[model samples]
Target chain A: MESIGIVNYWIVIALMMIALYIVISANNLIKKIIGLNIFQSSVFILYISIGKVGGGTAPILLKEPAVYSNPLPHVLILTAIVVGVATTALGLALIVRIRSAFGTIDDQDVQQDIERN
Target chain B: MIAIELVVNFTLLGFLLVTALYISQTNRLFRAVMLFGIYSLLTASLFVALDAVDVAFTEAAVGTCIATILMLSALSLTGSRKEVRFRRKNATFAVCVSIALGVALAIGIMDMPQFADPNAPANLHVAPYYLQDSYSEIGIPNVVTSVLASYRGYDTLGEVVVIFTAGIGVIALLTARTSKPKED
Candidate 1:
């Protein structure tokens, strides 16, 4: 039961490792971006998971008394999600430019092309 | 009830792990993007399970919808399918680094508070104050909205500026090629 209680954190860590693996192993620039997205999203989960209280409800007030989960993490993650969107958009835009410039999105090909140039 | 919760949590984690593995293994860019969208959707559901409705909403919107659309558009321009490479050394290095890092992280997590411990440091901090006073101070039902729009207004404004800057950067990058032809 103790392990079960902290299972959330363990899973979050596993997801992070998978994301890192994808980022490091994949050659496609877009795949790297996807891996990065996975990494960021998993971090988001980790933060939100830590903020949970055993019996907390969502952080919305009502007439009846209720336990609420931490609002701070939710607020922070909202800002992060927005920034993530912008960053991803910009990244994809840059990838488009890279494709146009090098004719391939593979890291090795692009590296060799740069060396030849 | 605890049993049910544990079951659901583990199931979601299992699905997330599988989806992530699929996304990494699929060399077809379009399939990978679709799987990433699925991953985001599952993550959003997990956020809901963790009682993060606002974060879940944002994840569904930005993580799944907007990010997927952006990646697909980029794929249209860049083309699908990854270039297969037989870089054994790089693969081995990446595997080693990822395993080392994963093990270190797992070991570190052993000291962390349980998933939903009410007495955890994170729950004992300013969060208690926010939960107690947000309604009276801001008169908003959603504590997250109040904090984001009022207490952290300046930060939100900065984020807006960031989005604006990114939009401008994307526009500039996309349009630069048109200007090159004219210059020639």
Candidate 2:
């Protein structure tokens, strides 16, 4: 039961590590960006999980008394999600520029090109 | 009810783990991108289950809709359908480092508050105040909206600036000339 309670965190940690491995090991720039998005989403999940309270509903008010989950983390993650998409857009744009400038998106290929030049 | 919730949580998390694993292994960039959309959808559903309706909605919209579109557009622009397959000399090293860090973090998690403990410090600090007073002070039924738009207006402003900067940066990077002028 105790393990079940924190299973989400464990799974999130695994996801994070997988993403980290992808980002570090993958030579493709675009794959690295995908890895980065996964990493960011995992962090978002962690924050939302932290804010969850057992038996609590969404943080909306009602005339009747009700328990609401913590709203602060939700608010923080809302901004973060938007910022995350913005970052993705920026990253993809940079990739497009790199593809055009270097004629290849593979990290090693670009490195070889530089070395040859 | 608790048992049902536990089952659902476990199933969703299991699916998430599988998707992450597939995304890490696939070399086809297009397939990877599509799978990432599925991954984001699953995450949004998990957010809904976690009582984060607003965050869930945003994740569905931005993560699934906007981010996917942006990635697809970038893919078409780059014109690369497959990742270049090469012998990864450092793959073993990276796996070891990730496993080591993950173990360290998991050990750290044992000291943290138990999940869903209402008395957890995160729940105690400023959250209760926002949850209780947002309605009375801001006249909004949604505590998250009131807190985001009213109480933490400055933070929202900063977010807007960050987004604006990102937009400008994307435009600048995408529109810049990549080739030098040819001499006649």
lDDT of each structure? 0.86, 0.88
Q: Which stretches of candidate 2 lie over 4 Å from their true place?
A: A1-3, B180-184
For B1-184, candidate 1 gives per-residue lDDT tens digits of 6566567767888999999988877767888899999999998998888789989998999899999999999988877655445456776787888899889998888889888888889989898888888888989989999999999999999999999999999999988753221111
In terms of lDDT, model 1 sits at 0.86
Native contacts recovered, each model: 0.76, 0.73
DockQ of prediction 2: 0.66
What ranges in model 1 sit over 4 Å off? A1-3, B81-86, B178-184
What TM-score does chain B get in every candidate? Answer: 0.90, 0.93
Task: Output the number of the lDDT-best candidate.
Answer: 2
lDDT (0-100) at residue A111 of candidate 1?
Answer: 93
Worst 10 residues of 1 chain B by lDDT: B175-184
